[model samples]
Target: MLMSPTVRSGTLVMLIALLRSPATTVAVPPPSSVQASAIGADVTAGKHLFERHCAVCHGIEGKGGRGPGLNRAQLAHAPDDTALKSVISDGISPDMPAGWFLTDEDVANLAAYVRSFSNIPSEPLPGDAVRGAGVYAKGGCSNCHIVAGAGFGYGPELSNIGIRRSAPYIRKAIVKPGATMPEGFLLVEAITPSGDKIEGIRVNEDTFSIQIKDATGQFHSLRKQDLKELQKLRGESPMPSYGGVFNTSELDDLVAYLASLRGKQ
Candidate 1:
């Protein structure tokens, strides 16, 4: 059951206080202790249990569905195995509920299973970044995407995209731009009373008002009541897909160049 707003506020206040209480807070449990506890724990049993219980939100492989992927970087909340074990047992408020029904050994087993996916993996690209830069320029990639301030202030900045996203993800984004529209970049078509239609990617929105930036780099601010029609297009980007634009080798070169862009222009 969800907590009432009043109860939630009080709980949040208490949590903040506890987080700030250096003297009252207990020491972080050691990863070694968690490992020792799970030395004889059945990982296969844990996987089965996880699929039955946690797979809906977190994928069967812990790759994330409704929740963040477990197979990524170190978890921000639970930095170590000891902390993770506690989180699994107690759970976080609001989003995660306490696992009071789970036995200590069961929680330990889950923790062990979860721990196995924390390794970060990277694939090496075969194409040359130098040649890829030329292809990027020819394809007018910089017109919308900014790499070290080379392009217009439209679309997503790609200066540090190499560090932010994986190579495979980048390739998918290029081939299918509208497949997964990014957050805060949802395409919206707003029509005014006099049959004036404004199509743009939303910048910000609230219950009362919305702000959108058009392809022409113009920002439109309008009240909810003023708009005759407001449509939100999910999984849609303004950028055209490069599915047929680039050949097989050029695509590989472009991806390679993008992957090589750690931070430079």
Candidate 2:
């Protein structure tokens, strides 16, 4: 693959990894909107909109989830700021439904947040996205994580994980499930009145009831009175550490494929 000529090869590989690094820089696409890119425009407002409206499918930080990540070298349908506004206002076909509900100001603010992704320093990497996809299928990540909206909702969706996390972070997460836990995933153990034992991911719970989903996608809902045990193991997750599961090359390939998934169908 032809590496981007903009940066040194080594730096490019590390570009997406150092999103917050001062040295890391993404080429800001030429701004087409004077109003949207205005300094007075509230970047914070845009971030809020993204977190509220777009985070479900696009990811918390424009990283991607069910939708393609906005943090990318280039956009698929729109590139310039003005075009981005149209994308936000009109929404696109196939997958990206329109957001006609947003006000003009909301569109302006959201555009700023989307534009910010261009400067996040995601150039490219050595790992291959296609082969990495095969790795994902083989690794059984879909059993827990969702990609392109097809998987058990038990685990965090990985459609936009590449943009949400860096290559090294992704690698570290695979080998260390306990290191960080996504927002809602909490390990739980439930024992029935008959002394039947169950351990799986805690899906949801209420004062009177609890729900958990196992690896097989079987959901077990237990009332608080019936269960012999229910424990919320904080700082814990059901995802197993892949340290011994994959070799170094396989890990790299998997990471590459995951990073390439920016919500594209």
Clashing pairs in 1: none
* Candidate 2 per-residue lDDT over residues 1-265, each given as its tens digit: 1122455756644543453345433443343443236333445678888888888767787765546567765675665677888988887653466888999889977886687776566546677778888888898888788998887666778887754555656777789988856556678888899998888888789999988887677899999898888877888867789999998888888988877666763
Lowest summed lDDT across 10 adjacent residues in model 2 is found at: 27-36
Lowest lDDT 10-mer window, candidate 1?
1-10
Steric clashes per prediction: 0, 5
Q: Each model's TM-score?
A: 0.58, 0.58
- As a whole number from 0 to 100, the lDDT of residue 185 in candidate 2 is 61
User: Per-residue CA lDDT of candidate 1, range 76-131, in tens?
Assistant: 55677678778877866434556788887788778867766665343457777888
